[model samples]
Target: MMDIDVPGHIEKVAELEGHDDRAWCVAWNPTKPVLASCSADKTVRLYHFSKTDADTENPSVTFVHNTTISTGHTKTVRSIAWAPSGTTFATGSFDSNIGIWEQESSDEDDEMHGEGVKTGEWECMSLLEGHETECKCVAYSTSGTLLASCSRDKTVWVWEVHPDADFECMGVMMEHSQDVKCVAWHPTEEILASASYDDTIKLYIDDPSEDWFCFTTLTGHTSTVWSLAFSPNGRYLASSSDDCTIRIWERIEQHKWECVKVIEGQHERSIYSLSWGVGKRRGDDGKGEFGGWLASTGGDGKINIYEIYEPPSSSDPKGREPPTHTLIATLPSAHGVHDINHVSWCPRQGYEDLFATAGDDGIVRVWRINLNGQ
Candidate 1:
């Protein structure tokens, strides 16, 4: 067993014990270590820990799921994501709908251990309807002004959130014929890329005035493109697939782009998870964190941490290896794990080095990436 960072450094922080179906999706609350998980059981559960007031070093926080929410969907939930603020969350379900959930509790309603009816204090706020078939995934733009939903009906829908008025249906993007499995937004641009079972990744871009538009379709993965992510710099895109490989795409001279590096020979089974780090980059003159690096999980029951090293020199030419990179770690069955579905980095930006992942084995594992190793 290779001692990699992704899984080996993880600890089973919590095990939600009541779901009757497979947990398909998990997301860390953008502002906290708290997390939410969606399941085929048709329910979404919220988990958090309340530290003891007296203990310091031996402080033990129990995994307490304070609430269970089930509404706005007629079938199993497939995907869930927390907004940057963490108070509101979005979920896409097999019922072809996206439901908005909010933290609905007052000081009186907020109990440390939770109150009656809803233990954890979460409620479905609104239901979004439009898709003709099951929705597979959903994401919010960096500004949280737009929400993107992808469905098996071969379309990606964008919705605009209006706090004072009824939510508006922005636009629909149809560029795939098969089920779209994943949708990812560029860190800085208005561009969005989606992976489909059709074996193609389509990049969609929207101007400040236009509702949405398709800029390009990246076709390379031989099998279904299971997952996709844009690098922290927004210049490169990393994707993993059932084809059993990880490929990186970077914008080249002018507007053209090319697959620069193919990180292979790492997985023995299908690659399922790809979580890019979410904190400051390695070297920034002590200015601030830029959120570089990445981690991945796959069907081989393993996880990998890929550090993005700085380029050696401008004269080194494009498409060449960076000055230095270290796999740092290879984790097999992280903490004796098996059947992990996905992995996610905490989205709090400039704050956390932690993340959470869930799988068929019914355990949510929390991992901390230690750069200092101090």
Candidate 2:
């Protein structure tokens, strides 16, 4: 059975329903509560709440940023990402293209010359071309140099986007046996990870000598791995699968990863999404590299969090219960229908405890966890 509980009631802060079709992807600005949701309607909508410094009681409860911008993408937008700098954003679409949008002051004078300040709004700056099929995922490198994208066409395209240059496809990895489902950039390094219907997760690293070839492929999932994440510390990885379980992977050795433990019995359907807490747990011993907490979504339409823990010590050899990783909170109807496709915490964890998920229901849900709740 899918373990689900919605203790926090929801409030309608705001809603934008102009999409012509289902909205499959929504992403929060890495640094702000500002959000962007893309839909099959061939359009992407932008929203920004004014008081970004303040966290809402229930993010879904009100229309904090009633402003909207509809542009970019010609088909269903499958994935959206906020650049690390938070001033620019990127999105991938079934239209087989990726576009970069940035917010800048309208005065064409100081703006283009780098004198004007950022306007905190988004506008289509340029479109990236390379993928041959629907681009399912797009991610920016940690150092903010490259943008990695994957598609149903069975390939991953790495683009070098920096210093305002025309997005150039640096390399392409076409080893997946089936449709590629997800792509993620290493939080701190120049590495990339991808999941595919081929029942495997693969890693790609830049090799100046080998033309940046795919030097590593991770295999272990019985079913398709829908989502993958590199821990904030870059020492661990987490994957959600159709197998209805979340697997924690540790770098047992260089170029090789091992499944350390399994987080099971939380969801009843395929695990559509998974994300490790982004930072160190407060009041923690600070010895280990990652595992502050974890969140996942699946066919059951719920978001569940757990404290990633070590095996019980000798005093409790009988086995202690899993650490509370605490379902500290849950996201309701997280897009509904067990058809949810993705769930991700903002890049910087512990900030408003904000996370977003998108799926078949045509809704991109944003949530905030209140640490000081009654």
* Strongest candidate by TM-score: 1
* Model 1: lowest-lDDT 10 consecutive positions: 2-11
Clashing pairs in 1: 4-329, 4-330, 4-331, 66-119, 66-120, 67-120, 279-291, 280-289, 280-290, 281-290
Model 1 root-mean-square deviation: 4.4
Q: What TM-score does model 1 achieve against the real structure?
A: 0.83
lDDT (Cα atoms) of all candidates against the true structure:
0.72, 0.69
- Indicate the residue-level lDDT of 264 in model 2: 77
Cα-based TM-score, every candidate: 0.83, 0.81
Q: What is the lDDT of candidate 2?
A: 0.69
lDDT of 2 by residue, 286-338 (tens): 43333555778877887776555543333352333332344555655655553
After superposition of all CA atoms, the RMSD between model 2 and the true structure is 5.2
- Regions more than 4 Å wrong, model 2: 1-20, 50-63, 107-122, 279-290, 310-338, 348-352, 370-374
lDDT of 1 by residue, 172-242 (tens): 98889899989988888767889999988888766679767877777788888888888877767888888
